[model samples]
Target chain A: MKKKIVVCTDLGPALSLLTLRDDLDVVVWPHAVDTECPRAWLLENVQGASGLVVCFKERVDGEVIKAAGSGLRAVSTISVGYDHLDLPLLASRNVQVGYTPDVLTDAVADSAVMLALMASRRTNLTTSLVTSNAWPAFQWTPFALSAPQLSTTLFSPKRTVGFLGFGRIAQAVLRRLTLGFGVSDAIYTPRPEAPPQVMRDAELLRGLMPNLHSLRAVDMPTLAADSDFLFVLAPGGEATRHLIDESFLRRMKPTSVLVNNGRGSVVDSTALAKALKEGWIWGAGLDVVEEEPHVGVKHVLPAEQGVREKCVVVPHLGSATHETRAEMARLTVVNVLRGVDGEQMESGLDLGRWQ
Target chain B: MKKKIVVCTDLGPALSLLTLRDDLDVVVWPHAVDTECPRAWLLENVQGASGLVVCFKERVDGEVIKAAGSGLRAVSTISVGYDHLDLPLLASRNVQVGYTPDVLTDAVADSAVMLALMASRRTNLTTSLVTSNAWPAFQWTPFALSAPQLSTTLFSPKRTVGFLGFGRIAQAVLRRLTLGFGVSDAIYTPRPEAPPQVMRDAELLRGLMPNLHSLRAVDMPTLAADSDFLFVLAPGGEATRHLIDESFLRRMKPTSVLVNNGRGSVVDSTALAKALKEGWIWGAGLDVVEEEPHVGVKHVLPAEQGVREKCVVVPHLGSATHETRAEMARLTVVNVLRGVDGEQMESGLDLGRWQ
Candidate 1:
C-alpha cells in the first residue's frame, strides 16, 4: 500500500504534490484562489499521513502532529523561516521539518533595496503627484522633490550603509548598494559567537564592493548613530521584538533612512511612526509590520498615519517573485518525497534535540 | 568693468552665481520657489548681460537671444539635453552654449533600474494594498501577485536585457543589471555610424558583467523580439518619436517589460497603454512621458488609464537627485564664468554653423 502524503494547499500541476502519485497516496486541498486551507479542513484531512506540506501562513503545532498520528515522518514548508511550525514538538515526534532557504535570498535582497530606494527617493509622494493630476501646478525646483540621495556623489561624498543583521540576504543587499551607489563604508551587527565561515563571508563582501574601504562589525549604538541608511534584516522572535524602538530611533541620525525587510516585530511601528512624524528620521520603508496583511494607515496607532505619509510600506512581499516562489514550491515537493523515501531530507531541520 | 550675468534660478550658495559675484555682476531670480523664471522677466532682465544661466524649463528662443543683444557671449543650461535651447538659433548669434553631461549618468541610470524593478515587482500594486487596508481581506497565494521575476533563478533561468540606445546611461544600467540580477545576455541598437570605440565598449561591458555570456548589437526587429526587459535609453527627437509604437509592442513577448528612462516622446503612450491592457507585454516603468510634468492619468486616451494601472509612472525625476542636481548647477555656473572670462567654456557646444 502506498503511504499517504497530504498537501495543505494546491500547488498546481507544474509544482504539484500529485507528481508522487505513482509511489504515494497524494491528497491535495483543492482551492483555485489565494487563500490558506481552512484549519478545520486541515485537521480532518491530515489524518494517517506520512508527510504534510505547508506555506508560511499555517501554524503547525502539537495538534497537527497529533492529527497526523504516528505515521508522519516529515513536515515540509515552502519558506525559509519555519516560525509557524513548533519545531520542538515535531522533534519529539521524530518528524523532521523541512524548509526552503537560500533559494529566496536574491528576491528578498532585491526587495530590501527597492524599499530603500522608494523611501529615500520619495517615490510614493512623487508618483501620487503624477496620478492625482497635480504635476502641472507643481514647480520644479532644485530641492522641490528632492529627498536624501541614496547613492554617493561628489556632492554627497560618504555613504555609510548599516545592516542590523549581516546574513545572506543582507550581504546581497550590500552588494547591490555597493555596485550601484559606490558606497564608501559599511557597519553591521555581528551575531554572538559567529562561526568563522561568516567572518570570511563578510571579508569576501568587502572585496566585492569597489569603493567600500571598510566593513566593520559594530555594536547597536554605533550602528544606529553612524548609518546613513539602516537596513534591518534580522530574524524574528521574542529577542528581537521592538529592537528598533524609541531609544534606537532617537540615536539614529536625523538624516538617516530606515528600512525593514526583516520580520515585523523587530521594529516598533508606533515608535517608528512617531520618529517619522517628529523628524527624528528622514523616512522609512517597511515590508512587514506588527499587524501585517492587516496593515493600514491606522493599523499600529493613530500615529500609524505617519507611515502612510512618510513611509513606503508594502504587504510582506519580500519573496513574492515568480521565479523564487516557483522554486520554493518545487523544493517543497522534493523535501516531502525525499523524507518518505527514507533518504535524508534536502533541508531538514538539524535539531540536535531530535537526536 | 565687471561682466553682467543673470541667473534664471537661485542655485544655493554651494552651486550659486554668487560665487562669482566679486568677478561679475550677478542678478539672480528673486523667488525662492521651484518655478522657472518667467519669459518676460528673462527678456527684461537679460539686457546687457554677458552671460545667461537657465534650466530646462526656459526656452532659449530667438526672442531671449535677441534680448541679450550681442552682449551674451554664452548661454549655459544646467541640463544635458539642449532641446530647450535652439542650437541653430544660438549659433546664429555666436552665443556659445554649455551643458552638464556625464555628471548625471549615475543618477539617471539608478532611476532607470529602480523603475524597472518597481514595475516588474508590482510595487505600486502591493504598496497600494498595504496603504489601503486591503491585504487582510486578500489571501496569499503562490501566483496571485506574481510578476516577471527581475532576476534569474533555477525555475526561471534565462534573463535577456535589451537597450534601445546604448549610451553612457544605458551602459551604467547594464552594469547594475549584470551585477545585481545575474543576467545572461544583452542586446542593444548601435548608432547608425557604428564607431569602433562603440564595439570596444560593448566588449568591455560583457567583461564587467559576470554570467553575461553574450552581448550583441541587433537591429530594431531583433531587439524587440529577443529582449525580456526592454529599456528605451535613446535620445528624444522627431526621428525617434513613438519608436515603441504598435508594431514594436506587438513583437515583444508577453513576459517582457518596457522601461523608458530616455525621453518622453520615444515610447508612444497610446500604444504602450494598449499593449499593457491586452497583455501584449507584462508591464512598463516610465520616468518620462511626452507631455512630461503635464502628464495626468487622463493625458493620453482613456485607454491610457491602463498605464496608471499596469505601469509604474514616476514624475520626470530621472536626475532629480540632490547630489546630481547640485553638481549640474555648479557646472552651469562654471560654464558661464568661463565664457565671460573669454576662456573656452568647460563643456561648450561646438556649433560649426557659427563659422
Candidate 2:
C-alpha cells in the first residue's frame, strides 16, 4: 500500500515536488474546492488520504481533520506562516506540521525596497504622464512631478526608516535601505526578550554601514512619528491583530510613505484609506492587502473617498521570482518527506499546549 | 548721455537685465522687424545705440552686424553655444562677444543619470504597463512585471562604468554613478595628454572606490564593447560629428545601455534607431536629438519606426532644473554686464581655429 496525499490550492512550483516521489499516490486539486462535499464524494475522495498539502485559502480545521480520521499522518504548507492550520486539533491527532521559511527573505526584501523607491520618487505618476501621451500637450513647468534627490551618504539628511516588526525580512530590508538608499536611523518593535540572532545580525549590518545611527526598539507611537518610510514585516496572529490602526497612522508625518510587504491583516485597511485621503501621508505602496486576489473595482476607492490618487497598489507578489519560488518548492518537499519518514522536520511548527 | 541698446529675439530676460542699469536705454523690435524696418525706423531706433543683446534663433550675420552700424561695441547671447553667431565677422569688426557656460552642468548631469537608470532598468516600459491598466489580471505567479532586483550583489559581480568624454558634467555624473550604483571600474576616452587636474581627480576617485580596476583611455569601439552603460558627453563640433555611428553601437553587448547627454549631432540618430529596432542593443535613453523638437510621425523612417516604441525619449530638458536654470540666467546677466563694462568675462568661449 502506497502513502496517499492530497494537494490543495494553486500548486505553482509545488507541483514539481510531487513528481519526485514515485511511491506516493498524489492527488492534486488545482482549484480551491469548497469544504462541504456530497457524502458519496467524501467517501470516495478522501478515504485513503495519509497526508495533506494546503495553502492559506484552504481552511484545514477540526472538521477536515475528523474527515481524514486516523489515516492522515502529516500536513505541510508551501508558505512561511502556518496560520491556516488549526494547531490544537492537529496536535491532538498527532499530525506533524511543516512549512517553508527563511528562503524568501531576499526576494521579499528586494520587493519592499523597490516599492519604497517607487513611492517616494513618484515614478509611477511621472511615467504615466509620458506613456499616456498627455505630456506633449500638457503644459509642463520646472517644478512638476519630480523625483526626490536621494543622497548616497549612509546618513540620509532628512528621512528615517522604521519597521513594524523586527524579523528576518525586516532586517534584510534595512540592510538594502541603509546601503542602497542611504538611510541611517531605524526604529523597530521587537517581541519581548529579542532573539540572539537578531542582535548578531544588527551588529553585522552596523559594521557595513558606518553612519548607521539609533537602531533601537521603540513603541508604536514613537515608530510612527519618527519614520519617513515605514515597512510592515510582522506576522499575522491574534497577538498582533490590528497593530497599525487609525491612531498609529495619525501620528505619522504627512510627507511619509507607508509600505506593506507582510501579512495585510496586521494593518487596518479602512484606517489607511482614511489617512491617505486626509493627507496624513504622502503616498503608499501595498503588495498585500486584507482581502487579496479578489481585489476588484470595489477595492479601488476614490481618491477623495479615502485612498489618495497617488497611492500605488500591487497584487501580493513579495516572493514572486522564478529563483525564489523554485527554492521554496524544493525546501517544502524535503520537509514533507522528512515528516512522513518519522525523522525530525526542518521547519516543523511547535504544538505547545495542544500537544 | 545714456548708452543705447537694441534687443532681438524676445527681450524677456535681457530686458530685465537692462533695467538694472538705469543709465542705458533699451529698444525692443516688434516682430524681429529689422528687415521690415524703414531707414527712418533704424535712425530712430539706433540714434545712440552702443550695445545689442541677441538670441541664437535670430540671424546676427555680417549683414545684420553692419546694419546695426558703427556705434555697436558689444553683442551678448543668453545661450551657451554660439553656432548662430558669426564669430569670425565679430572678431574682424573688433566687436566683443559674451555667452553663458559652466552653469548648466548639474542639471545636465542629473538628466543623464536619470536616462541611464531609466533605460537600463526598463522603467519606461514597466511603468507604462502599470499605469495604463495593461498589467494582466492579478495572479500569484512566480514571475511578474516588477521592478528589477537591484539590491542583490549576484547580478553586478564586478560592475564597470564608462564615459565617452571627461568634461565637467561627465565628472559630476561619474561621482553619483560610482557612489549610488556601486560601480567599480571607470574607463573614459582620453584627451591629448591628461591634465594634472584630471590625473589628480582620477586618483581621488580611485581612493573612493576601493574596487576600481582601471581608469585607462580607450578607443571608441573598445569603450562600447566593454562598458555596461556608456555616457556620451563630448562637445558637438565639426571635429567630432557622428562619433557614435553604426560601428560603435554594433560593438556593444545586447545587455549594455547607451545614454546621450551631449549634442544630438554627436550620435547618428538613424543608426541608433536601427540598432534599437533590430535588437542590436537592449535599449537607449536620449534627451537630445539631431533635429530636436521637430521629430514627429512623418520624420520617422519605416525600418526605424519602432525605435520610439522601444526607446525612452524626453523633450530637451537636460538643463531645465529650477536651481540650475536660475544660476544660468544670473551668469548670463553677469556676462552681459562684463562685456558692456570692458571687464574680463568669467566663461568666455575659446573661438580659436583649433577649437
Candidate 3:
C-alpha cells in the first residue's frame, strides 16, 4: 500500500519532490482551494491524511495531531522555526518532525544588511520626496534629505552591533555587519550555555574584525544602551516576546536606526509605533511586523496614529528571494524524504522521541 | 588706502572673510538684483574694487576683469569648478585666482555613494509602492517591483569598480565602494602622473583590499562593458561635454546603474532620460543635471513625461553638508585674506600668467 501524503498551504515548490516517488501518494492542494479554504473546513477534511506538510500560518497542535491519528508517521514544516507545531505532543505521539534550516542564512543576512543601509540612509524619505513631487525648486541648502555619511569614521569610533538572539541567521548578519559595514564590538544575548559553535564563531568574527573592541554577551538593557543599531534575530515564543519595548527604544540614541528582520512578535509594534511617532530614534526599517499584510495599513494611516513618514514597512520579505526560496524548498523535500525512508534526517528536530 | 571688494552675487561665504579686515571695504550687491547685470552698471557702481567675488550665474570675462582695472588683485570663487570663469582672460590680466578643492571631497563622495546605493536598490520604486499604499493588498508576484541584486558579483572570481575620472572625489568614492561594498577590482580613466603621495595612497588602498583583482586605466568602451556600475566624476568643460551620450549609455549593460555626481554637462541628460524610458539601463541617480532649478520640473512633472519615475534627482547638493561647507568657507576666507595681504594664497589657482 502507498503512503498517502497531504501537502497543505499551497504546495507548489515543496511538493515537487514527491512527484517522482511512485510508492508515495502525494495530494497537492489546489491553489484555488488553498486560497479559499476555511480553517474549520480544512480540519474536517484532513482527518485521514497520513502525513502533513505545513507552513507558517497553518497551526499543527495537539488537536490537529490527534486528528491525524496512528497512520500519520511524519510531519514536516517548510520553515526553519517550528514554533507553530506543538513539539511536546508531537514527541509524545512518536511523530517525526522535519524542518529546513541553514539554507536561508545568506538571504536573511542580505535583507538585514539591506534594511540597515536603508534605515541609516533614509532612502525611503528622499525617494518619496521626489516621487510625491514634494521636492521644491533646486536650491542648495545647508541641510537636505541626505544619506548619513558612512564613508568617514563617523559611526566607527563608537561602533557596537547588537543581536537579540545569537543563532545561525544572527551570526550571518553579524558577519555582514562587521565585514561590509565596518561595525565592530558586538553585544548579544546568548541562550544559557550556548552551543560551542556559536562561541567559536563569535571568536572567529572578533579575530577577523581588527577594530572589534568587545564581543561580550550581555543582558537586554546593556545591549539596548550600547548598540548604535540593533538586529532582532531571536525566536518567536512566549519567553522572547516583546524583547524590544518602549523603555529599550527610549534608551537608544536619537540618531540610531532599528532593523527588525526576525519575528515581528519579538518587538512590541505599539511601542515601536510610539517610539517612531515621538522621535525616540531616527527611523526604523521593518521587513516583518506583528500582523503582516494588515500591518501595512499602519504605514498609510494618519500620522496621528504613529504610522506615517518615519516607518518603512515591507510585507514580510525576510527570505523571499528566488534563489533562497528554491534552496529552502529543495532542502525541506530532502528532509521529508529522509524521514520517510527511516534514515537520519538532514535537519531533524531532536525531540528525544523513539518510534 | 583700504582695498575695496565688490561681490557681484549675493554676499556668500567669501563676503564674511572680506569683512574681517578693517582695512578692506566690502560692497554687497542688492540682494534682489538679477544675475544678468551689465558690465557698465558694475563699473559705475564699484569703480575702484580690488577684488570680485562672483558666483557661477555671474559671468566674469575679460570685459568684467578689465572693468575692475589695475587694482583688482584677485578673483576668488566659492566653488570647486571654474567653468563660468574665463580662465584665459584672468591669466592674461595677471589677476590672482582662488578656488576651493579637496575640501568638498567627503561630501561629494558621500553623495556619490548615496546615489549608487539608491539607484541599485530601486529605492524610488519601492518607496512609492509603500507610501502610495499600492502594495500589501496586491498579491506579490515574482515580477514585483524589486531592487537589482547588487550582491551579484561582476568580475570572474571577483568584482570590478570603474570610474570616469580619478580625481580626489572619485578616489574617496572608490574607497567607500571598495571598502563598504566589497568591490574588488578598479578601473579608472588615465590621468597625468599623480604625486608620490597619491600613488602611495592607491597602494595602501590596494593593500587594504584583499580581493582587489586589478586597478588599471581603461577607455570608455571597456569601462562601460566591464563595470557593474559606472560613476561619472570627470571635470566639466568643452573637453568632457556630453562625454556619456547615447553610445556610452547604450554600451552599458541593461542592468547597470549610472550615477552622475560631477557636472551635469558631463552626461547627456536627454540621452539618459531616453535610456531610462526605454529600459536601456536599469535606473539612474543624478545630483547634477544639465540645468539646475530647471531640472526640478523633471522630478516634479506628471508621470506622462516618464522622467519622474526613472530618475532620482536631488537638488544639486554635492557639497551641502555642515562640516564640509564650513571648511570650504574657512578656506575661501583664508584665500581672500592672503590675496588681500599680497601674500601667496592658499589653494590659489595657477592661471599660468599670474604664476
Candidate 4:
C-alpha cells in the first residue's frame, strides 16, 4: 500500500505535490479558498499519514503529531516561519522537519526597504490625502507632507542604520541601502546564542554592505540610541517578544525611523502607537502586528487607528511576490518528497536542541 | 542704495535668501498660510525689485518682468522646472536665469523607487485593505495580491530596465536598481539633439550600472518593447509632451512597470488611466501628472478614479524632503546673488537658445 501524505492547504504549488509521486497517496483539504484547513478535519484526516505539508495558519502541535502516530516520517511547511510546529515533540518522535528559507529573502528585503521608505516619506498620509479627496484642503508647502529621506543624496549625508537581527534578509536590505542610497554606517545587536557561523557571516555581511564605513554589533541600548533607521529582524518567540517595547522606543532618537519586518510579536503595538502619537519617533513601517489579521467581531481591530497617519502597515506581505511564492512552494514539495523516501531533506532543520 | 530683492513665498529657505547678503533689501509676502502669494500682492510687491526669488505657484510672466524693469538683472527660481518663467522674454531682456538643480536628486530618486515598489507590489491596495477595515472580507490566499518582484531573487533572474530620458536623476535611479536590486540590463533613448557630452555621459553611465550585462541606447519603439521597468526621466516642455501616450504604452509588455519621476506633461494621464483600466501595462508610479495638483470641485479628479488601484500618484513631492528643500533654497540664493552682481550664476541656464 502507498504511504499517505496530507496537505492542509490547496495552494497551486502545494496541490501540485499530489501528482509528483506515484508511490504516495496525497490528501488535500477540499476548500478552494485561501484559508486554513479546519483543525478538526485536519486531525481526523492526518491519521496514519507518513508526510504532511502545512502553512502558518495550521498548528502542528503535540496533538497533531500524536494523531499521525509512529508512521509519520516527515513534515514540511511552505513558510520561512516554523513557529506553529513543536520542534521538540517532532524531534522526539524522530519525524524530520523541513522549511523554506533563503528563497524568500529577496522578496522580504524588497518589502523592508519599501516599508522604510513609505514610513519615512509619509507615503501613507500623503497617499491618503490624494485618495480621500483631501488634496485641495492641504496647500503645498516646503514641509507639508515632507518626511525624512531614506538614503543620502547631494545635500544630506549618509545615515546610520541599526538592526536587531543581522541575518540574510537584513544583509540583503543593507545592500539596497548602501548601493542604492549611499548609506555608510550600521549598528546591530549580536545574537546572544549565535551559531558557530557567526564569524563567517560577519565577514559576508561586510562584503555585501561595501559602502559602510562602520559596521559594529553592539548592545541593545546603544543600538537604539544611535541608529537613524532601526530595523527589527529578530525571530519571534517568547524570548524576543515585545523586544521593541515602550522603554526601547523611548530611548530611540526622536528623528529615527523604525521598521519591523520580523515577527509581529517583536513589537508592542500599543507602545508603538503611543510613540508615534506623542512624537517619540518620526514614523514606523510594519509588515506584521501583534494581533494580526486584527479582525475581531467587527472585522479590523482598532489598535492601528490612532497612528495610521504616521504608520505604513501592510497585511503581512513580506514574501507576497509571485517569484518568491513559487520558489517556496517548490522547496516545500522537494523537502516533503525527500523526507517521505527516508532520504535527507533539502532544507531540514537540525532538531538536536530538542534531543 | 542697497539692491532690492523680493521673495514671493515666505518659506524658511527662500526667506533666508534675503539675509544671505547685507547689500540687498528683501521683501516677503506676509501671509502665514501655506498657499501661494496672491497674484495682485506679488505684482504690487515685485515692483522696483532688482532680483526675485519665486516658486512654481507664482507665474513670472512678461508683466512681472516689465514691473521689475531692466534693473532686474537676475531671476532665480527655487525649483528646477522654469516653466512658470517666460524664458524667451527674460532672455530677450538679457535677464540671467538661475535655478536649483542636482540638489534634490536623491529625494526624487528615493521617491521613484518608493513609487515603483508601491505600484508593483500592489501596496496601495493592500494597505487600504488594512486602513479601510476590509481585510476581513478578503481571505489570505497564496496569490491574492501577489505581483512581480522588484528585485532579482533566486527564482527570478535580473530584469531589463528602460529609460525614456537618461539624465542625472535617471542615472541616480539606475544606481539604486543596480546596486540595490541587482538589476542587470538597461536600455535608454539617446537624445536626438545630442550634445558633445553624450559620449562621456554614456561612459559614466556604464561605470555606475556595472552589474548590467547589456547597456545600450535604443529607439523609442524598441525601448518600449524591451524594458520591464520603464522610467520617464526626460525634461518637461513642449518638445517632450505626452511622450508616453497610447502608442508607447501599447508597445510595452503587460508585466512592465512604468515610473515617471520627471515631468507632469511627459505622460498623458488620460491615456495612462485607460491603459491601467484595460490592463495594457502592469502598473504605473507617477510623482508628477499632466494636470497636477489634480484637484476638482469634488477633490479627486475623475481621470484618476478608475485606475487608482494600478496607479500610485504622489503630489509633485519629488523634492519635498527637508534637507533637499533647504539645499535648493541655499543654491537659489547663491544663483540670484551672483546674477545680480553681473557674475556668472552657479546653475544659470543658457538662455542663448531663446535669444
Candidate 5:
C-alpha cells in the first residue's frame, strides 16, 4: 500500500514533485490562494499519514500529534522557523521535523537591506509627494529630501552597521552592506559562545571591503550607541522579546535608522513608535510587526498617526520572492520525501532531544 | 580692491569656506529656503562679480552673462551637468566653468539601486497597503508579495544588470549591484570609443562576484533584449531625448525594470506611462521625468490613475543625500575660488569648445 503524505499549504509547483511519486499518495488542500489552511482541515486530513507538509503558518503541536496518531513519522515545513511544531513530542514519538534554513538566508538579507534603503531614503514620504501630485512645487534645495545614505562616502567616512544577531542572515546582510555600500565598520551581537568567525565569510568580507576598518563582537549597549544603522535580526522568544525597547532605542543615534527584519517579537512596537514620533530615531523600516497580518489602524506601528508617520511597515515578506519561495517549496518536499521513507532528511531537527 | 564672489544660493556652512577668505566679497541669496532665486535678482546681483556660485537651477545663459559684464571670470555650479550654461559663449568670453562630479557618483548610484529595489518589489503598492491600515487581510502564501529579487540566488543563479551608459556612475552602480545583490552578469553601452575597462573596477567586480558570468559592451537593442533590469544612465539632450521610447520599452522583458537616474530628457515619460499601464514592462522607477519639478497631475508619469499604478516616480534626488550634497557644495566653492584667481579649478570643465 502507498504511504499517505498530506500537504497543508499551496507551495505551487513544489507540490508536484511530491505528487509525481507513484509510491506515495499526496493529499493537497484545495482552496483560494489567499485563505490559510483551517485547523479542522489539518487535524482531519493529517489522520493516518506517514508524512505531512506545512508552512510556518500551520500548527503542529500535541493536538496535531494526537490527531495524526502513531502513523505519522515526518513533519516537513517550508520555513526555517519550526516554532509551531511540538518538537519535544515529535522527538518522543521518533517523528522527524524538517525545515529550509540556508536556502533563504540571502533572500531575507536582501529584504533587510531593502527595508534599510526604503526607510533611510524616505520612500514613503517621497512617493506620497509624487502620488498626491504635490511634486511640482517641491524645489531642489541643497538639502531638500535629503536623508542618510546606505553607502559610505567622503562626508560620512565611518558608517557602521550593527546586527543584533550575527548568524547566517546577519553575515549575509553584512557582506551586502560591505560590498554594496562601502560601510567602514561592523558590530554585531552574536549568540553566546557562537563560532568566532566563519573563515569563508571572513575572507569574503575582507576581499569585498579592502579598507574595512573593523569587525568586532560588541555588547547590546555598544551595538545601540555606535550603529549608524541598527538591524534587529535576533530570534523571537521570551529572552529576546522587547530586547529593543525604550532603553535600547534611547541610546541609538538620532540620525540612525532602525530596521527589524527578523521576528516582530524581538522589537517592542510601542517603544519603537514612540522613538520615531519623538525624534529618537530618524526613520524605521519594519517587515514584521508584533501584531501582523492584522496590523490594522489600531496597531501602534501602523496607526496612520504621528507614531507611525516615520515608520515603514512591510508585511513580513523575508522569503516572499518568486525564486526563493519556489526553492523553499522544493526543499520542503525533498525533506519530507526522504524522512517518510525512514531515511535522514536533508535538513532535519535532531530527534536526540528526548535523550 | 577685493575680488567679488557672488554666492547665489545658500550652500550651508560650505559657504564659510568661501566667505572666510578675506580676499573676496560674498553675496548670498537671502530669502525663504523653499524659494529659488528669481532670474531678475540673479541678473541684478552678478553685475561686477569675479566669481559666481550657482546650483543647477539658475540658468547661466546669454542674458545673465551679458548682465554680469566682463568682470565675471568664473561660473562654478554645484552640479555635474552644464546644460544651463552656454559653453560657446563662456569660452568666447574666456570664462571658466567648474562642476562637481565624481563626488556625487556613489550617492546617485546608490539611489539607482534603491529605485531598482523599490520598483521591482512594488514598494509603492506594498507601502500604500501598509499606510492605509489595510494590512490585516494580507495573507502570506508562498508567492504573496513576490517580486523579482535584486540579487542572484540558487533558484536564479543567472540575473543580469544592464546600463545604457557605462560612465563613472554606472560603473559605481555595477560595483554595488555585484557586491550587494550578487547579480551574475553585467552589460553596458559606452560612448563611442570609450575605454574598454577600468582595471580597478574590473578586478573588484571579479573578486566580489567570483562567479560573474559575463561583462560585455553591447548595443541598445541587445541591451533592451538581454537585461532583467535596464538602467537609463545616458546623458540628456536632443541627441538622447526620447531614446527610451515605446519601441525600446516594448523590446524589454516583462519582468524587467527601467530606471532613469541620469537625466529627464532621455526617457519619454508618455511612452513609459503607456508601457507601464499596458504591462509592456513589469515596473519602472524614475528619478527623472521629461517634465520635472512641475510634473503635476496632468503629467504622464504621476497621473494618479492606471498610467502610474505600477510605476515609482522619485523627484530627481539621486545626489540628494546629506553626505553627498555637502561634499558637492565644498567642491563647488573650491572650483570657483581657484577659477577666480586665474588658477586651475580642481574639477573645472574645459572651456575649449570655441578654440
Candidate 6:
C-alpha cells in the first residue's frame, strides 16, 4: 500500500511533485472561497496520513498530532517561521519538523533594503502627493520635499547601517548596503547569549559583507544612537517583543531611518507613531506590523495624521515575491518526501533545541 | 574695486561664500513671493554685472546678454541642464559657462533605485491603499499584492540591468544594482558615436562595477528585450525626445521594469500610459515625467486608472536631497566666483560640444 500524505493547501505547480512519485498518495484541500486552510477540514483529512504539509495559518499542534495518530512521521511548513506549530508536542511525538529557510533570505533582504530606500526618500508622502492630485499646486522649490538619500553623497560621505539582530537575513542586508550604496560602517546587536561570538567571526563576516570597513557589535542604546539606517531583522518572539520602544526611538538620530522587516512585534507601534509625529526620527519603512493583515483605521499606525508623511507601510510583503513563494513550496514538498523515505530531511529543525 | 555679480535667487547658506569674499559686489533678487527670478528683474539687475548666476527657470539668452553687455565675463547656472541658456551666444561672446554636474549624480542614482523599488513592488497602489483609508477593506491573501522583487533570488538568480544612456548616473546605478543587489550582468547603449569604447573599457568597468561578470553594448531592440531593470539616464533634448516610445516599450519584456531618472522627454508619456494600461510592460518608476510639476488628474500618465497599479510617479525630485542641494548651491557659487576671477570654473561646460 502507498503511504498517504495530506497537504493543507494548494502550492500551485509545486504539486507536480506528486505525479513524479508513484509510491506515495497525496491529497490537497480543494476550496476556492476560503482564505486559508480550515482546522476542522485539516483534522478530518489528516487522519492516518503518513505526512502533512502546512502553511503559516494552520495550527500544527497536539490536536494535529492526535489526528495524524502513529502514522505521522513528519510535518512541514512553507514558511521560515514555525511559530504556529507546537514544536514541543511535535518533538514529543517523534515527528520530524521541516521549514523553508535560507531560500527566502535573499528575497526578504531585498525587501529590507527596499524599505530603507522607500522610507529615507519619503516616498510615502511624495506618492500621496501624486495620487491625491496635489502635485499641481505644490510649487516646486529646491529644498521642497527634500529627504535623506540612502546612498553616500559628497556632503554625506560616510554612512553607517545598523541591525537589531545578527543573522543570515541581517548579514545579507549588510552586504547590499556596503556593496550597493557604498556604506562602509556597520553595527549590530547579537542575541544576548551570542555576544562573545561576535569577535571570533570577523573573518567569516568579511566573506559575508565585502568592502565592510567597520563592523562593531554594540548594545541597543549605542546601536540606536549611532546608526544612520537601523534595520530590525531579528526573529519575533516574546523575549524580543518591544525591543524598540520610546526610549530606543528617542535615542535614534533625528535624521535616521528605521526599517523593520523581521517581526512587527519587535517594534512598538504606539511609540513609532508618536515618534513620526514628534519628528523623533526622520521616517520609517515597514514590511511587517503588529496588527498586520487586520490593520484598519483604528490602528495606532495609520491613525496618526503626521505619521503618514514620514512612514511608508506595506502589507506584510517581506517574502511575498512569486519566485520566493514557489521555492518555498518546493522545499516544503522535499522535506515530506525525505522524511517518508526514512532519511535526513533538508532544512529540518532540530527538535532537541525546542526541548 | 569690487566686481559686481548678480545672484538670481537665494541659495540659502551657500550665499555665505559671497560674504567671505569682500572683492565682489553681489545683488540678489529679494522678493519671496515670486517662484523664480522674474525675467524683468533679471534683465534689470544683470546690467553691467561682471558675472551672472542663474537658476534653472531663468533664461540666460540674448535679452540678458545685451543688458550685461561687455562686462559679462561668465554665466553659471545651479542646474545640470543649460537648456534655458543661449550657450552658443555665450560662447560667441567669450563667456565661460559653468553648470553643476557630477556632484548630483549619486543622489540621482539613489532616487532611481528608490523609484525602481517603489515601482516594482507597486508602492503606488499599496501606498494609496493605506493613505486613502481603503486598506481596512482590502482582504489579505498570500499573494494579495505580490509584485516583482528587485534583487536576485534563487529562482530568479540571474539579473540583467540595462542603461539607455551610458553616463555617470547610469554607471552609478549599475554599480548599486551589481554590488548592492548581487546583480551580475549589465548592458548599456552608448551615444551614436561611442560604441567602440564599450569593448575597450572592460578593466576600467571592473573597478567601477566590482563583481560584474558580463557587460554588453547592444542595439536598442536587444536591450529592450533582454534587460530586467532598464534605467533611462540620458540628457533631455529634442534630439533624444521620445527615445523610448511605442516601438521601444513594446520590445520590453512584459515583466521588465522601466525607470527614467535622467530626463523626462526621453520617454513618450502617452505610450507608457497605454503600455501600463494594456500590460505591455509590468511597471514603471519615473522621477522625471513629461508633465512633471504640472501633472494633475488631466495628465495622461495619472489619468489612466489601470496605470496606477504599476506606475509610481514623483514630481521631478531627481536631486532634491538636502545634502545634494547644499552642494549644488555651493558649486553654483564657486562657478560664479571662478568666472569673475578669470579662473576656469571647477565644472565649466565645454561649449565646443553644443556648436
DockQ leader? 5
Error of 4 at B345 (Å): 1.5
| Runs off by more than 4 Å, candidate 6 | A32-34, A198-201, A204-211, A353-355, B31-34, B129-144, B208-210, B352-355
Q: Write the per-residue lDDT of candidate 1 for residues B143-246, one digit (tens) a residue.
A: 67877777776566689999998888898888777766677788888767766455676676656655676788888889999999999999888878998899
Instruction: Give candidate 2 regions above 4 Å deviation.
Output: A9-18, A30-47, A67-69, A138-140, A152-159, A187-205, A211-226, A236-255, A263-280, A293-309, B1-148, B151-355
lDDT of 6 by residue, A106-179 (tens): 87888888889888888867876876788877654466677777777657778888999878888888888887
TM-score of chain A of 6: 0.94
The superposed Cα distance between candidate 1 and the true structure at residue A322, in angstroms, equals 1.0
Ordered from best to worst DockQ, the candidate numbers read: 5, 1, 6, 4, 3, 2
Candidate order (TM-score): 1, 5, 6, 4, 3, 2
**Model 5 misses residue B291 by how many Å?**
1.5
Candidate 4 lDDT over residue span B1-355, tens digit each? 9998887754564555567679989887776237667789878988888888787777999899988887888998878878899999999988899898788888888999898898898777778778777755666556668888889865687788999888778888888998789888888987788655557657765776566667788889999899889989888889899988999989988888898888879988778878888888888888877766664334332235557777887777877887788777777888888888899999999999989
How much is the lDDT of residue A233 in candidate 3? 83
Q: Which ten residues in a row have the lowest lDDT in candidate 5 chain A?
A: A200-209
Q: For candidate 4, write residues A1-355 as lDDT tens digits.
A: 9999888864675566667778889888877346668899899999999999888778999899999889999999888778899999999988989998898889999999998988888877777667666655666555566677778864677789999988888989988998788887888897778645557657855775556777777888898899889999998889899989899999998778999899889988778878988889988998887767763234222235546777887888889987888777778878888888999999999999998
Compute the lDDT for candidate 2: 0.64
Clashing pairs in 1: none
lDDT at residue A282 of model 3 (Cα atoms): 68
lDDT of 5 by residue, A1-355 (tens): 9999998887788777887899998888776266778889989998889999988889899998898999898999988888889898898888988998888887888888888887888777777687677887776678777889889876678889999987788888887888778888988887766767657547756765574778888888999999999899888888788999999999999889999888889898888888988888888998888867778667777674665657888778776777888888888888899889999998888778574
TM-score of each: 0.95, 0.63, 0.74, 0.92, 0.94, 0.94
Second chain of candidate 6: TM-score?
0.93
Model 1, which residues run further than 4 Å from truth? A13-17, A154-157, A192-202, A300-307, B15-20, B154-157, B192-198, B300-307
Off by over 4 Å in 4: A11-20, A136-138, A192-210, A295-306, B11-14, B136-138, B191-210, B295-306
Which CAPRI category fits model 6? medium
Give the i-RMS of model 4 in Å: 2.7
